[model samples]
Target chain A: MDIGQTLYWIGLAGCAVFAISGALAAAEKQHDIMSFILLGVVTGIGGGTVRDLILDRPVFWLVDPLYLEVCIAAAGLTFFAARKIKFKHKALVWMDAAGMALFSIMAAQISQQWHASWMVAMVMAMITASFGGIIRDVLLDQMPVVLEPEIYVSASLLGALGYLLTCSFQGVEDGSANYLALAIGFSIAFSVRGAAIIWDLRLPKFPPPAAE
Target chain B: MDIGQTLYWIGLAGCAVFAISGALAAAEKQHDIMSFILLGVVTGIGGGTVRDLILDRPVFWLVDPLYLEVCIAAAGLTFFAARKIKFKHKALVWMDAAGMALFSIMAAQISQQWHASWMVAMVMAMITASFGGIIRDVLLDQMPVVLEPEIYVSASLLGALGYLLTCSFQGVEDGSANYLALAIGFSIAFSVRGAAIIWDLRLPKFPPPAAE
Candidate 1:
């Protein structure tokens, strides 16, 4: 596939995965159908919405109705399928990792197109890859997983830096370089997150000071 | 007092009121101190944050520490004082109306400064006046009050248009026009909301269509 098509498919898959994960999360809370749909739609589009707002563009889903339709379908599918599935927590973690990996690279690419600084690009990528879950948790009245000592934002940061470094490399053809960079970015994020889960790795904690 | 000082005090009072409203709302949910603080901060600054993000400026509260300090104090005091307060709901609605009015005028003034079209300015004003509460509701896992068949967005819309009309007539001489416009705008919103509450007024709803 061409670079553009590859990116499109990756994003679509990411959206679907995120929608499923969101539905599952809502199911854990025993929310009603409308609430589940709301979570699914927000999780599917949240990253891109934040990115577009920051970029001062009309939101991507608003521009394309298909994104909304897909989210709706995914929410319905997830709601029914969740009842039949076991080990849902494991599936949720991996699906979230996949979504984060895909969105981080996509956000970085869009930022580069806007000619923003690398720092800005990276920040956008992290926000795009992470804020959806944060919003989902906050809306569910739970503390966000981002605030937990996980490899969440850290993994996205690594992926974004990988994409940036790949863009800076010479002698690679344009089409080949884009795919390679995206693949590398996704792999980095996915691998880090998977390893963190398996190894139970965590970032250092900041203990609250004792009150007098 | 000069118009600027008047606006300053009004905005501060609005922030304090919104913060108390947020604290009360969270208290109803039985949220802990941290969540209460977070909700209060969001309710007080959320509208301006949406405005700045849309305008592509650094978030206003982040740029101005005074806003953050005020929100924190408002939440802290509200936490202690809520038990002693009667008619909390009445106070919240009134304060929210004042905040909405001030923000609508301020948003219009800012948009005019940017030299945007009047339509864009009005839209910005409405967004600035209503988005915080919308966001607070959404984050609290409730349907956005704006999307409900309520007078919320309509009130902001009317207030914004009132500010615009006043500006067109009186011009922005010595900022007097600004505060006067805001007062008129707030009065309009408050009156409309009060009428809606008293009369149980609701927007028209369409009946469900026949089955396909």
Candidate 2:
């Protein structure tokens, strides 16, 4: 199979995983079916929507309905199988990491197509990777994962840099380079995040100073 | 005062009003002080940020911190006065209408400066007037006002059209034309909204079809 097609399938898988994670989150909160479906759709397409809006392009899902269909199916499956699932939180984090890594590379690649500066491309990648979860958390009335002094944003940044570096080295001539870079990026982010979860590695927090 | 200076003052007052409304909303939710402050800042600057971001211009508040300071002061004042204030919701709607009217005109005027088409300019105006409150509602886990099938979007559209029509008639030289248009817009929106609230005039909802 061609590399681009392979990467497309992998990205779709990532979307499905994230949709399941979103459904699990909503189920944990005991939301209705409509809310669960809404959350799933939002989580699956939210990153790409923001990226396209910021870039002044039409939304990706509007151009192709596959992403939306995948999200719907994932939500439906999760709704029926919620009781069968175990280790929900662990699954969520891992799936989120995969989704973030995939989206980051996709954003950077799109920006590169637009011939944006490297810095702008990197920023777009980070926004695409993290802003969906941020919006989700904000809507859930919780502190965004990005603001939690976690390694989340840092991992996304690292993944984006890895993708950019790979693209720079091998050039865009070989389609396989894209897949290779994405794999490397996703592995880095997921491994670091998994280690963080296991070892409880966290960023330092500052306490409020004494009142005068 | 010159017409430009007068409009600027009115716009600043609108900003303050929206800031207060934002603080009141936060107070209702019983958020922490910092969260309240953040809400105020977002409500005050969110519209302009969305406008500038869509227009691909530098964000306005980042260029001038005065807007931020004004919002912060307004939030602090509202926090202290919230309990003592009577008819808070009424005040919020009136203040929001004023802000929406002013922002709609400002967005159109700015878009005209950019030499954008009238259609694009009008859309930008509507976005600038409504996006902040939409973001606020979305963050608060409520349905966005824009999606409520109400007169909110229509009000902003009409306000922008008013500004454009007045400018055309006055040759953009008559200083009073701006304020006249703004006043008309605000009055129309506020009166309609107030009547709706008082009389319980709601848009018709779609009835569900009978199950088979």
Candidate 3:
């Protein structure tokens, strides 16, 4: 498959993974099935939706049915399987990292395809990787992970920036470069996030104001 | 000014109002100036941004600096003034209602200008009115007002639908129709919200699930 098609499929896999996490979140809230589907769809496509919106392009899910189908199916599957799932928190964090890495790389590459500046590409990468979870957290009335002390946003930022800078050679074909960037970016981001999950890596909190 | 220009100016006013409300929300949390500015910008343009995104159009703030400028000014002004202001809770609700009404009506009209279906227009109306507050509440880690015990989302929906239906007369010119619709929609929405604030109008919550 071409780079575009590969990103498309990989992005769908990311969506499914994100949808699973969203469904799991809704399950934690003890929300009904409809809420599960809603959260799943929102988390699955929310980032790409934000990206497409900013780029003046058609929203991916609205333009195509497949993404929504995958998200819904994932939500349904997760909802049913959640009862039997062990170590749910650990599973969730790892799956979320996988989805974030996949989405961030794809978003950065696609933004580059749109001829966006690297800054815009980085912002799109962060949004694509994090906005869905943000939306899910908002709906569930919980603090979003992106705003928490985890290394998630920084990981996505570094992954997108590093991938772009490292793959700037003119001689390399676009398709191969894209795949290489995706692999390298995903590896770097997933590793950082996995470290955060395992080691409780965090940005230091601000000290309280001195006697106000 | 023509209908389009009138709507543009009114929308900017709405942005400022929303920005002020966002700043007020940040003040309630005693967040830093940066958080205040972030919330202000997000709340000021967030609803319209969502509308543009869903419609596959360029983001409003990204396309025009005016929106961002207003949001920043409001945020900065409110940040400095917030300490002097007391009894803020009452003022916050009124200002929020105003912003919601203005945004809802303007969004409905703009959606119609894009030749969107009435259903799409209504949805846009709701998004444009409520999403900002949702963002603000999420940032503050509170239950969003739209989902809270108040006649919020339904008020926007009714106002948009009522205004469009009422303005669909053969003799009215397009400009007059838009103005009339805006007035009618804003009035309808604002009145419902005002009553809700005064009377604590709310959708009846489902009684806690009986023993699971």
Predicted candidate 2 versus true structure: per-residue lDDT over B1-212, tens digit per residue: 88777766766776777777777776666554444555676688779878988778766654445666788789867766676667777777667777777788788777877778778878998888888787666666667766775567777777777767767776762324366656665566556655655675666555633432
Candidate 3 chain A: worst 10 consecutive residues by lDDT? A203-212
Docking class of 2: incorrect
Q: B176-212 in candidate 3: lDDT tens per residue? A: 4367767888999999999999998887767745645
**TM-score of decoy 1:** 0.57
Residues B1-212, candidate 1: write the lDDT tens digits: 98667767766766666776677666555554444555676688778878888777765553444666687688766666665667766776666766776777777777777777778888998888777777667656777666777677777778777777777788662324466677777777777777776676877655534532
Which residue ranges in model 3 land beyond 4 Å of their true spot? A1-9, A23-42, A49-86, A115-123, A135-143, A147-212, B1-13, B19-42, B49-91, B111-127, B134-212
* Model 2 error, position A144 (Å): 3.1
- List the DockQ of the predictions in order: 0.08, 0.08, 0.14
TM-score of chain B of each: 0.87, 0.85, 0.91
Q: Which stretches of candidate 1 lie over 4 Å from their true place?
A: A171-177, A207-212, B1-49, B53-212
Candidate 3 residue lDDT tens string, A1-212: 77667777888899999999899888887888888899999999898887777777778888888999999999998888898999887777888899999888888887776666666677678778988988888778787777665678778877887678767754332324366667888898889888988899874322213313
Better candidate by lDDT, 1 or 2: 1
Error of model 1, residue B11, in angstroms: 17
Clashing pairs in model 2?
A: none
**Ranked candidates (DockQ, high to low):** 3, 2, 1
